[model samples]
Target: MPDFSPTELAVPGFVALVLIEMIWARRRNPRAYEPKDTLTSLAFGLGSTVSGLLFGGAFLALFLWAWQFRLFDVPWSWWAFALCFVLDDLAYYWVHRFGHRVRWFWASHVNHHSSQHYNLSTALRQTWTGFLTLGFAFKLPLVLIGFHPGMIAICAGFNLIYQFWIHTEAIGRMPRWFEAVMNTPSHHRVHHATNPRYLDRNYAGVFIVWDRMFGTFEAEVDNEKIRYGIVKQLGSFNLLWAVFHEWIGIVQDMWRAPWGSKLGYLLREPGWTHDGSRETSDMIRQRWQERQGEQTKSVSTENPIAGEAEPA
Candidate 1:
């Protein structure tokens, strides 16, 4: 069976949602939809689609090649479809988590987070260089295990489609039960936040269960407003610069480093350095934790009775 792209089919719906969100934002706050930022996001989305058209076949062919070595003929049933969806989501979770943790992957992934505004268009800001990053390697195991390549493709397509709507600030938290089980706009807002506490949290593609189980889940704090975009904001609105700037930075970083440390610049976490100069998400989170601890201690010192509770 030929693989159908669900994302391609969802293009009209995507455009409609963007339009709706723009109207909604204008009424709520005109500042939410900046003309340049929205256009830049749409351009990146276009680039990603074009790149996929050019390079998608190569990756699909690779998956089919690997499909020849089947461990079992997992038949397509309702149950199999359900299993594939769950497993594919699990694959996506790790792929996404590593996209932040590993610089090589982040080079392609960074553009998605380049926009400072969190709206429907921000979800469309996708990567054009994903094939170069070999992020698809994560899905090969599903094919080798006998879930047909087409099934995997369908699951992945639906996964991408599902994630589209969660990229907005327009929606608030869902019912508590839904929020707990599934990825909501609120949870994804935290994921895109560059705040120290929000860094690298909520990597779920469809299900929030993976994040909660893996200890990556963070509730969207009411106190700390989400500041979207990367730690260092892109200085230009040039589409080419937005797309390839991180890839260029990797080359520049590697050029000055010693041979032994060159791989670290590429493979280590995004903020890692040969010397202890920069901070990774882990380091940032640790520092934030220490600051919170100190604040708690200071409060206790200032009011011992407030810190103390009488035994019942």
Candidate 2:
């Protein structure tokens, strides 16, 4: 193991600055992050930084050693970095998709969905154990293909930075071409939404085109407003609870459910409501509005089902 200088310190600094600005800007409108939200975000953000960097560093070492050992006839070029970006993102899509579909991965990822507001601070509310689970598999190809360890770290960091700005609600849809090709605020908000239509939809990181290409793309519908947070709602803001709470709930749900339903709840799509409940969030919300006899505001105009996970 080589001495680590905590070079990734800048990642957290960048995150903090963005969070501060989000606070400053939202102060007037008062949609700024709530105190509990801030505390939870900080806990996960710091926890993830420590875990991701340490795990990433260890993998970085292995990547370096593999290159030095001449495991493959490696090629270096600007195009290689470009390829790395694509491959890295492709790997991310699967990992992210799995996170929503698998009860265990959801344990790690649920903290992110714990946030109700989609802002830069929301991006920092990441999972502490995600890197330990699905994130590393995506990087393995780079090592095997002989991309240098330093380059891999650089590309990973660069991808992280590129994704930061996509967290904002300030930016609307970019030009049609840009939105079609890349992930933007609009697309990411759809990813964060829990509205039945927006559940488990967009999973792309830097490129929205992947979702478009792969049939996961959902356009933002103007009439429907965005509501963030996971289904079943996280009632607490404690970081530890936020991280493990879903896993605990899944266990409890499984224990209480019949054996078959228990497996179905964890393995099947998240929207498969327990106890054969027919009404989804969409139905409940619409009925509530109807009962009130208010003019119906469109659910989010964004594609409803934007980020729904694949069934088990």
Candidate 3:
């Protein structure tokens, strides 16, 4: 297996930061860290690590196999590292976008979004079944484009590490210049939010520029409340239920679906259905936008700014 394990080395730092954030949450907002929720999230992280241990060798083998066909022999250097980091992030952006857009992938990703509380622990709420989703295929291009699978693996580690600190309400916003280019707490919060307008947006892993460029960017509105978790909140903290609920859902839908449309259960957006019974993110956003428009129109029509009643 190609080896570079920045994530393994960062474990201590992660624990310390989680403790610091927990202290901060106690002082600032106790609601930010539910004991059960945090425990569930940590369990999710532990399970995800075990899953990676089991499947990582196979994934690495695939990447290394593809490396033989690389278009360029990108050498190990500072510039190569920089290029790999950026490209790996770009790959992450698409993988993340698909994780929401496609149902099969979302079954795994939804594990990360199951908790209602948002905090540093929330960042550790990873998916145990990510290997089953085949999301790592997104990085195949980087390997085939000449980045060493090991270097790409290192960059991916650093990318995950970078994302951890952003999953909090402890920071309102970053410096304007930093937020403009980097994925900050502000940007990632919108990604976690279940609000209609915020759904399926801000998919950047390291760089915020990808979402802005792809038109999936949505700024957090100070006046708008953000409710964390999936569209349908899983009320229980039962760890097994949290991990497998969506996977079970996908299987159930596919089994019951007609033969011709069964694949839609796997391929379509998370809420898509055969009988128009469910609402996709697009549908939810569209309804929200229309309601907002009507509200604006009604406000303007009913309370016209009376032309300052003929000046004195």
**What is candidate 1's lDDT per residue for 1-312, written digit by digit as tens?**
764778889999999999999889988968778899999999999999899989988988888999999899999899999999999999999999999999999999999999999999999899999989999999999999999988998999999999999998889889999999999999999999999999999999999999999999999998887899998899789999999999999999999899999999999999998997888889988999999999999999999987898899
Clashes of each: 0, 21, 0
Best by lDDT: 1
Task: Please tell me which predicted candidate would have the highest TM-score against the true structure.
Answer: 1
Candidate 2 lDDT over 1-312, as tens digits, reads: 223233365576666767576666666446756767867777878888788767866766666666665456545578987887788788778778777776667777777888887777777787777754545666677677777766666666667777777877777779888887888889989889876567778888888777878777777888999988887777777678888776777677778887668776676654455675644444655666585444323332344464355689
1 or 2, greater by TM-score: 1
Which stretch of 10 consecutive residues in model 1 shows the poorest summed lDDT?
Answer: 1-10
**What lDDT score goes with residue 6 in model 3?**
89
List where candidate 2 sits over 4 angstroms from the true fold: 1-20, 57-72, 257-266, 271-312
Q: lDDT winner between 1 and 3, please give it.
A: 1
Candidates in descending TM-score order:
1, 3, 2
Q: Is candidate 1 or candidate 2 better by lDDT?
A: 1
